[model samples]
Target: MGRDFEAADHSAALIEQVQEAIAARTTLRIRGADTKAALGRPIEGRTLDTRAHRGIVSYDPTELVVTARAGTTLAQLEAALDAAGQMLPCEPPAYGGQATVGGMVAAGLSGARRPWAGAVRDFVLGCRVVTGHGKHLRFGGEVMKNVAGYDVSRLLAGSFGSLGLITEVSLKVLPKPRAALDTALEMPAQDMPCKLRQWRDAGLPITGACHVDGILHLRLEGGEGSIRTAQAVLGGERGDGAFWVALREATLPFFNDRRALWRISAALSAPLAPLPGQALLDWGGAQRWLKTDASVETVREIAERLDGHATCFTAGVADEPFHPLPDGLLRIHRQLKAQLDPHGIFNPGRLYAAI
Candidate 1:
């Protein structure tokens, strides 16, 4: 009864804050730890600090599901999972110790291990959110087989607090791999697509792959025997685990350039085109990060020709950070936003200016 009372008090407090914001017609910045404040378009609004409402709600290692409040820090969640020999398979980036699980899902930024393990959204099972009108709603479920409608939980993953405020979330977890190893080889940027294709076809245990500074780095995670075999097949030189961590968190010297950062998501089979500046290829060649002074039009044109889209991740070179959606898709997004947040009081314009 005492625990239930505390939970009720927490919910009431959050709801009251939202209701007040709605009453004043003031936009609320849905914040969790504030580590990702630099992301997305800047917003002017009263802050809704979620860190005050933090804790793990539940964890069942046998079921491979952990439910926690949105304010829970990523370190806290990862430590708990690490204790059980499990982890969030998506390998979400921890930009800092203050990074929150909500911020991870909200920003929807995946780490080096995305291609093999999955994305942050893929591991998300469900979420409890507060709509702009201050109504509490739950979508999806803790169990894997609980597919109902719309898959709204996953939709909210990359929404960046545009749709609603996520209060709690349940995620699917995986057991940590027994062993991991990194292998590196110097290679040209244009040659990476073909090499990655060959590796993918070879069916090795490559959990992470990135090409930066003429070096193709591959991470293999699995049993010791399999890693040894893979290392022999794809030999270059042994690499340290710290390399991948640096790449994931953008701490490497390659990311320190003073230029616009564009993230291009293209087909692995797409032919590599010459770009203006430094580039780092990740996700087995599907995701490429380019730091260049080139105009957004040039970058988007090249990406579009390759059957992909370019997003201006930082230093706004594009009018919109995300690629412009097709007419039909844009209509759907507006409709969904209207349905969930008719008042337009939740992180307004954080995603698209019109939304």
Candidate 2:
């Protein structure tokens, strides 16, 4: 039982790569397993693989915190947490279970429980990163605390590795719920959102909610009494709890289609709006995944009208996977990019071509 928990510190090696790229005026593509490769815009550069630096640095089950090197796979971290009966509340996806800890924070996509539990960024406590300047720096700490300046740690979340190389991260965790229940009710698609809102406002133990193919899928968490009470009130047939995992990992039959996929983030009550293909509602309509053959403009325009924005998950379907930012926001992103990776040596064009 003497497996090594101490990970080799490869920050020096990563920092060296950044320094070399900076001196040569070339770019560096920060990567961890490359599992989220298709999730962002393409960039050309020498790959800075983080997998060589892997291990759980420190874990405190009593404090509900775990810090691990970026190269450590989510499954690895989850195994440790599972042993302690704790979990990463964000429920980040690990497609084919190859997603690494760095990639999880970089991609920043969460599962159905995200609405109730919080997001990947929300659980991020701190991180150690190698900036474009070829310097190693640590931000935040093991515990949640006030950050006087930049919250660069959490900012790395969903950054697609454009910011810098995230070598390690400290994340807040939570004990598993005492009891959980999964159920599904057949209902009109349009009514699902409203009902979910009602339940949320009433403070039910509702943790996961989705409506796909006229079935409102639900997950209840908390004590046994609370789940049982909610289940009785909601009155739905028992559902396969594994369904949530499938959706989280993008393994559901709904995602098997070759059609381009659009992720629409809108208010919980946002309408499905017209789609070129079909839509699956998750997070109780806060998120809508559409399988469509429509043009990028059509998909984004629909999301805009709903006061939301759309991101294309299918590469080559859109020049920019993420929705375009306003001129001012774009400028700020460029500024931050310059400040961190002044030479633009880190994952150039990974987030946007303009940046």
Top candidate, metric lDDT = 2
Task: Name the lDDT value of residue 142 in candidate 1.
Answer: 95
Collision count for each candidate, in order: 0, 0
Please list the C-alpha lDDT of all candidates, in the order they appear: 0.83, 0.87
For candidate 2, the per-residue lDDT at 220 reads 91
Supply candidate 1's per-residue lDDT for 131. 90
Model 2: lDDT of residue 73: 87
- Which parts of model 2 have CA positions greater than 4 angstroms off? 1-6
Clashing pairs in 2: none
Candidate 2 lDDT over 135-233, as tens digits, reads: 889988888888887799998898888888899999999999999999989998878767877887877888888888878889999998888789778
Model 1 agreement with the true structure over 238-324: per-residue lDDT tens digits:
977888879877889988998988889998678777777888888877888999998878898988987999888784566778888
Indicate the worst ten consecutive residues by lDDT in candidate 1.
Answer: 1-10
Model 1 gets an lDDT of 0.83
